[model samples]
Target: MKPPTDTDTLTAPADATTVENPAVGIDQTAGNFSYKVDYAFDAGTGLSEDTVRYISSVKKEAPWILEFRLAALKKFFSMPLPTHWATKDLEAIDFQKIRYYLSQGQKPKRTWDEVPDDIKKTFERLGIPEQERKFLAGVEAQFDSEAAYSNIKDIVAKQGVIFVNSTEGLREHPEIFKKFFGKVIPTGDNKFSALNSAVFSGGSFIYVPKGVKVAQPLQAYFRINAENFGQFERTLIICDEGAEVTYMEGCTAPKFSTSTLHSAVVELVALKGAKIQYITVQNWANNVFNLVTKRGIAHEDAEIKWIDCNIGSRLTMKYPGVVLKGERARGEVISIALANDGQHQDTGAKMIHAANHTTSNIVAKSISVGQGRSTYRGVVHIPKHLKGCKNNTECDALLINTNSRTDTYPAITVRGDKNSTQHEASVSKVSEDMIFYMQQRGLTEGQAMSLAVNGFINDLARQFPMEYSVELKRLIDLEMEGSVG
Candidate 1:
């Protein structure tokens, strides 16, 4: 098939006021868009020991990895669905009906032209290549369960930084990979995490050498092309002592009549005096169920931060977390979630203080439109022995309509003396009077609403990279277009 042109992939909604300039390339104007692709190999529907073995065999994984997969598979089957969680829709996922893996069965290519046409076109629409050329130091593009393209700038690679798909990282850097693999986030941490461990496919593995500071960000983009499929990507990032690195990831899937599943496990490790920033922007189709487990460990004087934005999905339950394992370590979480129509976004942060003189912060914002529901669930723990520990958590929700719903459940356990902690939460609605005030200035109701919502998350949005911030604002504007009557 001929590769699709830019015009073919990007379809602007009729009501869209802004046409995304290709220069900035992350197009927020494209609405519920998708293309067809043929898979070279597909592990037929259902999950079992056979399916796990098939996936491992296809990847030519090492024996140890295979053993891990089998053990995790057993755990997945034994574990029950999280019925007590905020998202009751967990009962709707039919694990037996979803394809465990789908891939083109090709090694990652360094050049865009060498990438499969259909897959290339998909990333082209998302502007992955262009973004790599402009700002990113390294890029990995995952298409339906595997990385189709992975490359790093020669200059950065020469600096002793390793950025590759998890498959290659396991094969090439077993020593480093094994030391921290599943150490931060164990396979049995949760059911979804176990599922990801059992059938994990393409996700990025990054290692920054000691004392090296990567000035530019490394990125991975995941796209799901098959229907009724389960995408399980495992990502691990390690920052050595005195090292600093920033990594970003984005995901999207086609609109399918039947539900699709995305379950991923991400683990980050920051050694003594190191720093790591992990960012994620997920815009899955409304029929997709996104359940993920992400956590990091910060050693002595180290830092770890999670910047997350969730926009589109039938249901999303993710809590990016951090463990301060060494004295003076720091962690922060900045999150923004928007639930529209029939969607539900359940996301928050977890901070576990295991040492003295540690600090943690969490700032979360959510917007609910139509009948959508947005929830914030978080946990902060400080043991009795820890001193000089501090925590601050703030959660705010914005309701667009009367039917819209919002909930906040924060669990804070503090047993230490001389440790300071603060928690704040507020829920508000867009008042007619505010809209009228903006309308008096000749702005339409939709524009006013968009402006209001943008202002609500402006602080958190500013925390995003410049390019992403622009696209995020555009997406918010698009979501606000028809929000009000």
Candidate 2:
């Protein structure tokens, strides 16, 4: 198929007019709090190159990180537009027009109450604190550019599990931070990753000690309330030998006419006999660009899993990958995506087997409504030297309307005759008969459609922790209501 040639063009919205009142908190839905292109960097304005330098210099980083940033900046400047299976509509992103970072204070609050009232209100509206107060083992809340509040249970901390913001992890625990910061995914992996490396900020750093098992999951909440802005958060997780940890991230942004960017890089390392599970649920505004890179490395006898869901974004490009570097290592990815009216969601996963007796699995489901489009692009490889390796891949798509579209592209290479590989794909539409049956059962058309959509995603939801599973179901129900009618 010929590539799409029409580059997207985004016009700036009218200049923002906001009224500042010390008595009233910043309104998340109001334009007064939105981001605008400003030449000067001051207390009110967001982060700049100077701010990046300040962060690095304050950490007293080794010369290597600085050198890496300089090289990454060069790559970010020279890299051309991505033409591979992407919806060219995202080409209009104006790098110079965005504020790379925004924050209300200097450092992340050590205590929950230390967080500013305005930012706390934003989380309150989203029911974040309630989630933590109910069941989460720990919670980290990031507003705009930086984490405003971060806390871990005393029992978990006493068990030698390190949970904190990446910036603080680097400043206080340089010995461990330097060892695995970029080992899983290098700085020069891709253009957006390189950009994240050059100016990354405000993401989680987690380490689970040997022989320890965390009973409850840790969570992070990210919010973007500004327009013409980008959030570049960096996250890293290390599960030591025989340890286990589950991490979840949830995000939302307000609506805007102009485009915003969310480009982040995440890496995970699972050592021998360890297990790590990473979950991401993203609901961006209708006019934002979501491009992210996430990958993990599993050593001998280790396991790693990724559960991802993408519901809203003008354009999205994400592919989570895993590299099995040791005998009997395991990896799995289960994802669900929904695209609505003028949106495009392109997502998949990669699995590479470098040792004997390794296994991998991939299950992906996509829903397209209105004029939206969805695609599944993936790769699986087993080298000739490997033996007794196995892989299974499944891709499914559900189209809600005649105008919606879905595509699947899977590349599998198995050089060893002893290996086993399986691939299956299916595309189904919401059947009229099924809708009729539900309608006859005393349900409205919209309610029936929403129930069907939820059923399609129910498999993936089970992989999430109980609390997160409930939240994800609710979010999907809300999205379904808007499209069903």
Candidate 3:
């Protein structure tokens, strides 16, 4: 496809700020735009028990939830940064300097018409409304600390599928939400998870009933609008026996002079004979510290898969994981990451085989451009007791400059002779000769480079939904031009 033209831009309403370039991002990367608005509620700066209590009180949360948040705040304070294993850049995150919550204090509207104009314009510029109208079964748009709008298609809602933000799920569907919440990835799972549990706000909560299959995908969009702020959203999805669903999320934050934090926790549970597919595509500004933890559990004869794509951030450390807990369960992860100058994409996957005849697969590709760095760290394990378990892993990297760097850390352990596993890794730079040939054939250097990069990850990109895959390719093409610039 040729490069995106001016017509492809996403424009805001007359009153909201407009980004001339559709590629100005948060559409894909920079999320670089802003507008004026007044927040009715604020948790103020810094993290403490008082901050947590204020958040709980503002939400009118249950006493048990307040208790949980206070406990998590203690856990967060006691834990230290994982600089020993992770990058030292994480040490720069000043917990006390960040504002935990800022919102307009509006309940999520079921109709776009009821949404405040400013918030609605933000989502409009991001194409949230248009996309939902075209294909999604449900949609949620979150700005800073709260969801501004959330709606589900009538047909899908009639199927007994519950799609709402986390607050509603906890208060309205506690009988189901309480059991699975924090059970997959608890507060102590990591420091960031604890932080999220303490101040968590807007995120998608979906429950698919037994034997029900959602026909269209459900999508959520996350935006961070303020400076020196943190957005902590919690998402949980549960698929009952014989049910199936696909959920996707997109995130972006505008450029900030100071550091911004986007820490989130996601959990998924697939019951017997159920299937769940999760997809995330994030493009953040260089000021964002994108640290998130996502994991899923697959029960007997169930399947879980994650399709993750990362494009921009100052430093990103995320590893999506899956635990195969019953006989014949399956899990898979497909990932693509691009790191530009002054950015690091540290990402991978983890798979644990716990029962007989389980299987897992992982495929990851990275592009390092102009001194950018990308690392792939993965773990796959099958204990000696598990028989006939199998796993396959592949990591590939493409460098666009001599200074670009990539690393691979694969920890694969299979104890039983009955288990089988395979791993493959490759690293290479962009071929100057191919770029010259494409230029000779009437392609610009940027176009040629984008073509080469797209070729390297096209097969993996196709794993996304059809329209989204096309958009993914466009995203790559646009970012390749920026890398060259």
Evaluated at residue 93, the lDDT of candidate 2 is 83
Name the 10 consecutive residues with the lowest summed lDDT in model 2: 1-10
lDDT per residue as tens, model 1, 308-409: 999888999999999999999999999999999999999999999999999999999999999989999999999998899999999999998789999999
TM-score of 1: 0.94
Instruction: Estimate, for each residue in 1-485, the C-alpha lDDT of model 2 and write its tens digit.
Output: 11212322222332334323322211222212433322211122343455456545543566777776667777777777676646677678877677775544346776778765556656666677777777888899777667878888887898999998877877777788789997888877887898888877789999999989988888898777766768888899999999999999988888877888999899999999899999998888778799999999999999999999887888888989999998999999998899888889999999999899999999999999888899998999999988999999999999887899999989999897999999999999988898899999988877887788888878877777776677667666666677775
Off by over 4 Å in 2: 1-63
Candidate 3 C-alpha lDDT tens digits along 1-485: 11212221223443433545443223544356776655667788898888888788777788988888898999999999998899999999999999998877778889989887767667776778888888888898889988888999999899999999988898899899899999899999999999999999889899999999998999898989989999999999999999999998988888989999999999999999999999998888888999999999999999999999998889988999989998999999999999989999999999999999999999999999998999999999999998999999999999997899999999999997999999999998887888899999999989999999999998998778986787677778878888776
Candidate 1 segments exceeding 4 Å error: 1-24, 27-31
lDDT of 2: 0.79
Clashing pairs in 3: 25-31, 26-31
lDDT of 1 at 478: 76
Please give the TM-score that candidate 3 achieves against the real structure. 0.95
Taken over the whole model, the C-alpha lDDT of each candidate is 0.87, 0.79, 0.88
